[model samples]
Target chain A: METDLGYWIIPLAIIGGAIRVSTPFLFVSLGEALTERSGRINLGLEGTLVFGAMSGYALAHLTGSPWLGVLAAALSGTLFGLVHGVICSLPKVNDIAVGIAMMILGMGLAFYFGKPFVQPVAPDLPAISFGWWSEIPQVRAALEVNVLFLIGAALAVLLWWMLRATRVGLTLRVVGDSTDAARAMGLQPAVIRTCATAVGGAFAGVGGAYLSLYYPGSWNEGISSGQGLMAVALVIFARWNPLACLGAALLFGGAGALGPVLQSVGVSEGYYLFFAAPYVLTLGVLIATSSPTQAMTGAPGELSITK
Target chain B: MPFTSLSRRGFLTGTVAAASASAVPQLGFAGSHSPLTIGFIYVGPKDDFGYNQAHAEGAAAVKAMEGVTVIEEENVAETIDVQKSMESMINFDDAKLLFPTSFGYFDPHVLETAPKHPEVRFQHAAGLWSEGMPTNVGSYFGYIGMGQYLNGITAGHATTTKRIGFVAAKPIPQVLLNINSFLLGARQVDPEITCQVIFTGEWSLAVKEAEATNALADAGCDVITCHVDGPKVVMETAAGRDCFVCGYHANQSPLAPEKYLTGAEWNWAGVYTNMVQTVLDGGTIDNFVRGGLADGFIKMSPLGPAVSDAARAQFEATKAQIMAGEFSAIKGPLKDNTGNAIAAEGEGFAEDDIALESMDYLVEGVIGSTS
Candidate 1:
């Protein structure tokens, strides 16, 4: 019951929780970041997430490796996104509505396929301990973290650099800013948006895989608690920046750890409020950062929700 | 050997006579009756290792019995779909005994369906309807508190922190009953033992279950139990974290071998077999039948190998005491979460009382709102 905070346990818990909670948000937000940069919003990532989780877990269980689960999740998510993109490419169908329908279909399929995966003991992802030098067991325990968190962080940084320096990023930004501008530059807006949506969906699917294979080493209907949707909200909070998404995700993680940390220290009265902290903080930040005056003031001009 | 041997003509005649003799009893039985057919409808997929699976397993047991034909329709969502499904089973399958096994199916759909099939017997789970009360409807549920109490003892004795957690799907009466029983049972071992309850409000979500477990673990709860469908999340995550856990609905020890203590299991085979046989015999349908440890309907699964022999023996003794009426697991000195004494000392809960029926309060050691 005694936690030596100075021994790096608290620091590790903060850092570890940040990584654990942020991985899903990182993938989801980064994917959204890319998609938004390409002038499209795929709200269907929630469905993609649940479906990818089911596909990944089922495939992994069948194939006997967690990495296979991730691959399967990505492939399934990409396919789902592709279907959504294709359907939304129609002349009159609203992309948001298609996204909603896809979410329902994805969840239904996930639950349908997830029936056989109820009681499985799937392989878990290996954790890489960054605090091996610490002699204290507490530090070691805190430092023991999932490797995906690091991957997500590194991916975020790489994404940030790509957006700033890469030609693809420039094309995506142009496509996002104005379809006319993209057309003027001889770029096909539809093709870029479709690819962006699919890739974003793949990231959401990976986030779901992180849930099933790393933090929780099994699949069930309860594997996600609105994390897919939360990640969508997080994208807006991060303002479509990959690096800011990482910080935002870790903040959500810290907020998530509050109830437990307080309860650990014998505080128990306001646990429900603590449970709602991340959502509240995200909403607060959104309102604080965004202006209501201009339709597309802070957001990319062609973005759906902002415009 | 020579004496046993018969001539070819005599052997042929004897074989014919033996076959006739066997056929006569069946002929007499069949002359006055139709073959018994039972049907089962599950709310979720039959593979959902919790409630639906338990119901399906019961149906399977009935199917194995002689003269009983069992047909099942899984994934029967509780809607107009149920009415249609029931109609198909009744008209096409000729099912005389039907079990619509989900709480959601108990309302207007069943109410409408049960009366239309007057000749058929309907045995429902969790509702308080019965055939004699209304021609051919019956209700049955286990006193799961019995098993929960036993689990509490194991958790209470096993836990180093005296803080146990329960990851419940919803705050439904059934789940609430288990939580209350678990807390009461833990309190019996140590009055100071506190139970933190987390409700995901959805049935059988493993992601939420694991998240809830991690939350509880982070909150310093060293032993966890769940009223959820599957125990994999709680069992797997708690292993080597020095946390003890118990399964629900089925034996999940194989999922987390060393971490499992014991679980409350509903042994549906006996209930299934008995109900099916009653239909086969063309007996007058009983209004309702409650099956529990005494009837061998409800039982605690085998303790995992990790449990000490002493804990196992203690559990067995407790079971025996409960069976013998020498123990009332929910007997009082019971107090509500508000410190109000609900049951006086040495005064056990009356079997017919409303405590189990309208269970809506947290036990003394519970640290959450029942609402």
Candidate 2:
């Protein structure tokens, strides 16, 4: 019996997998970038992401509309972000500590609420097939991209423009760079930071929705596998640039797909090692970019890590 | 006259109870004096439709008993957290027996905690408990490879492409055994049939499982099955791609009814109930207990509507042979995928063979590498 074992399947599989896997990463990092740019870091986006995935899946299953699920997820994420922002706005409260607490709370709440939605199938987000020109099935499957991913790609560009070319962008940059300067400028740093964090959380929630309502497409307790936390590292790797976040997410997704792609083509040597590609890439990028004597470029001046 | 008669009846009941208590002093510790509290801890959600769910079903069976009270904790990590859970169940819940149903919980979590609570019994699933381990700690596992072999038979008949796929979590011995058995079962129908396997490297990565399933479908594998913790994603993904699916760990027919083939399901309910019953009757279970279909440790899911009559007949016949100990999945004259000899001619290994436990290679007709 003849088998279609060819080298061509490797590249196609990886490309398709990267697009599919990167959607959540793209959103989470973009959200994290927005939050960090306002001099606050929401490390609890992992929890927010999971909660969003759960709520999004549940609402989609209940309403029979995938778009409604995304909206519900975004709303839940906004609420989670607002809570984080309000709590961090208190005097003497540490943002990192609050973020950690919020992460646990968010995950716990998601698991509790997500129990009922695990078995039911929610409406999935639609995909636009770009492989109509190709006769090959692999190519068609590879080019069949989810709409959420395209939206994420477009959001990345929009965020880049807003952060660089808008009046709101300048205020955010000023507040992130220096608190005293913001106070002198008559801008309430706490209020601006809180609002930024809330919006960032909304981005994360959408990312979660993509996980449960599109790719892999289910509401399970283990749906989000640290993609939320990895976005934190990815934000730094991208220099807090939204466009860079998009590229970095795709890169991570490709690295993640490397193991399974090779195995598909009967290349199983160092298979487990290939699964670690994303984490290794993250560590490698972080090590390569770090400098002991100076703050990281593009890092917010008032960001707690830098301080 | 009524008071005198009631007193006489109470005296007779007391005499009988005292006689039985003295006769079975061994049962004095549990179930006789109070309800037996059995604690169950899972590494994931109880309704995951995979490994944890199978064990949770077992716990449910134990829960249904007369003198048994079951306590359950889910989503507990396989770290010191499990140890804390075991300790809490022992102290707070007064649990006398614990089933930490994750392989990772055995090494230090169960080993360290078992010695501290010498009176409490700890039975871990899929862990190899040796002689040197704590006397109170034991291990139990089902030879689900037999079920996988049966799954392969059904998959082989269902496949029009003559190609099937297996999405696995790791290349561990147990997983490798399942993969080999699945392929071997298919080869029984048509020796020309081939299986391609993809390992996702984690037990519960939903996205990776989906990607692997798609990769297989793209490669033209019409019948797909998996050994992941949760087969829900794989089943759903395969069904979405219009591929026939064979399930693992638990019944996944509800997830994909139309495309569903039969599945390999763990029958832990019987095992758990029997263990609890033994403890209730003042009998002790073995330190290391293992069983296959014959012993009721594992079972095959009902054949779905897609299974052909020929396939059903073969499955039932093979199942009967397995139950009667007349057949084995790993037979003689077998070779690894690399063309290396795995078994000499006339050398067959039964389901309980220790040699089968250290499997490090994929069988012939399986297009994948163990390394």
Candidate 3:
């Protein structure tokens, strides 16, 4: 069959691509949000994503339950983040460098431990159908997205509410805004950051688990495809807001899905250019939203990256 | 986190000094019996429809044979940790035969482990360790040149610019040999064909592979081939970019079917089956068994539909000549990229010089080093 996309395919592809890309971004950006809210930035979550995928796939294969893989991934991710937190908490270590180091360490450990699990056929996460009520095909197609998509949406709303309405959220915001201020209020900065990192790591881990245990039910080196790194970019584009993170992730996902959608319409030429869409969009938004003089509008004050 | 029970069992009693220690001897080792356990250690995550996947396919084939159990560890890193993994299989699971399937693992790990466990057969894929006069270890590889040569032929016939490119992980002799064969095959079709080669110095880096492929494409090399893994990015990147690629180690025609000409494919099933049969029959596992095209171990994938029938016929005829020992692909009035004669006008490189295992130079058009 010819690889082409008629005009009709673009809208559906947009819907499909948005769903596909948003899940990984949602998980990662939310994790980054939580971590940043607790006064830490984890560049190492990318490594956690891959290691979590490996761990999750291996565990699910061995245990014959996908949920076990999810749990394993979350646990592995938390362990990695804990290590990152502990190392950065040292007297003189830079959090950014420690994050980079943890990224490398996490990847090495994943490859080392992941060697035995390449082509395992683990039980994938079950999908929930919201398309049943929608009679129109486009709406149905959009509604029939992965269960994680809805969960991600719900999570965004929950996080937005939490940050505005909850005591714990206020504590996180306090920590993120000013470590000195947090210490003045009798809060332990290290402990808060460590716990936040752990929670963020769990989110990153579940993102990885989604890769091997849902969309692609096997572990391989190329599974993550820089999704973890891109998620980091997505967080900045979303301005550290969880709801904004969801919208940004879906947009990134749609961009990513462009190549396959185009190819389906008999547009095989220059497919690689399409593959660069997500990165291009990420870079564009990053440039558009980020301000050199007024970082206050777009980023948290104490965030090292923004500074 | 790995299976806690494995570490709890403490098969690796010591940690600091793995290289020097004799591997713990295989316990309960006896002659071949009903249920033979074969352990496969892979370097890459399987399922690229490429090298590791081909090996896994072979493992699956061997597993189907009566009374054989295949255990595999995917994505094994090339590190000191492989020793611990080797120990787990030999000392803990009692694998009768071990396939520690990467070129880097040949030294230190395989060489060290061989003397320690004389009973268990060690069959490494694509290393120079022969069944050294009956040492229960064997090294096997295919006439990948057969496939490389075919790729060359396709490149020769198809290139509009007549400038071909090769992206390799390293300039090691094995990779060099493929480059040489590809050049030789292309030159055989048209004498003026020149090749340009670049080495990424690391295997399986999608971004780097893409970069190398792009650099070649930008340098006016319209046709390309690679000794790197996951040419998915390379081929896909080159798609609609006015470039054609001959893939290595798998049937990657589908990835960029329009632009893909043909590729070198490993028939892992052949070597794996032979090793399994040898282990099953209680035959002495030689120190190394150097297998080439004759053993059906190395072969080319089917040419893409784009290849002209005339070229395909010529490829088949040349393959037969190589198989018949009438002509070696590297037999030559050979020259390096500079056109300096490496081999005499009438004589080709000796079997020792240009064989599958020890090739070391870029052919007449390549622009890189083995180191």
Best by DockQ: 2
Give the candidate order by descending lDDT: 2, 1, 3
lDDT of 2 by residue, A148-187 (tens): 8999999999999999999999899999999999999999
Candidate 1, A1-307: lDDT as tens digits: 5233532333455565665566777788888788777767788888888887888888878898888989999998888878877787777778888888888888888988787886666777788887699775445545667877888889899988988899988888888889899999999888888888888889889888888887766676657757788888787788888899899988988677654444433445556676677889887887787667755343677887766
Question: Per-residue lDDT of B1-371 in model 1, one digit per residue for the tens?
Answer: 32343254347555755676688765433334456777899876676557777777888888777776778887677798887778678765667788998877777787777876788778888777634456577777777777888898888777777788888776777788888878777776688899988765566655445556665665567778888665666678766456788878777778767888888888888887876776666575466666567777778878877677767777778778778754666667788877888788888773334466677777777877654
All DockQ scores? 0.19, 0.44, 0.07
> Which residue pairs collide, candidate 2?
none
Q: Report how far residue B112 has shifted in candidate 1, in Å.
A: 6.6
| Residue A134 error, candidate 1, Å | 7.3
Distance from true location, Cα of B204 in model 3, Å: 1.4
Interface RMS for model 1: 4.1
Q: What residue runs in model 3 are displaced by over 4 Å at the alpha carbon?
A: A1-38, A47-174, A179-307, B1-34, B130-134, B338-340, B350-356
User: Which regions of candidate 1 fall more than 4 Å away from where they truly are?
Assistant: A1-18, A87-94, A130-143, A251-278, A304-307, B1-45, B63-98, B104-122, B129-136, B184-192, B350-354
Q: Tens digits of per-residue lDDT for model 2 on B1-36?
A: 646744675576567557766997775444446888
Candidate 3 local lDDT, residue A272: 56
lDDT string for model 3 (B291-360, tens) is 4555677777678877888788888887777666545676556676656666766776533332446655
Displacement of residue A13 (Cα, Å) in model 3 is 30
Candidate 2: DockQ? 0.44
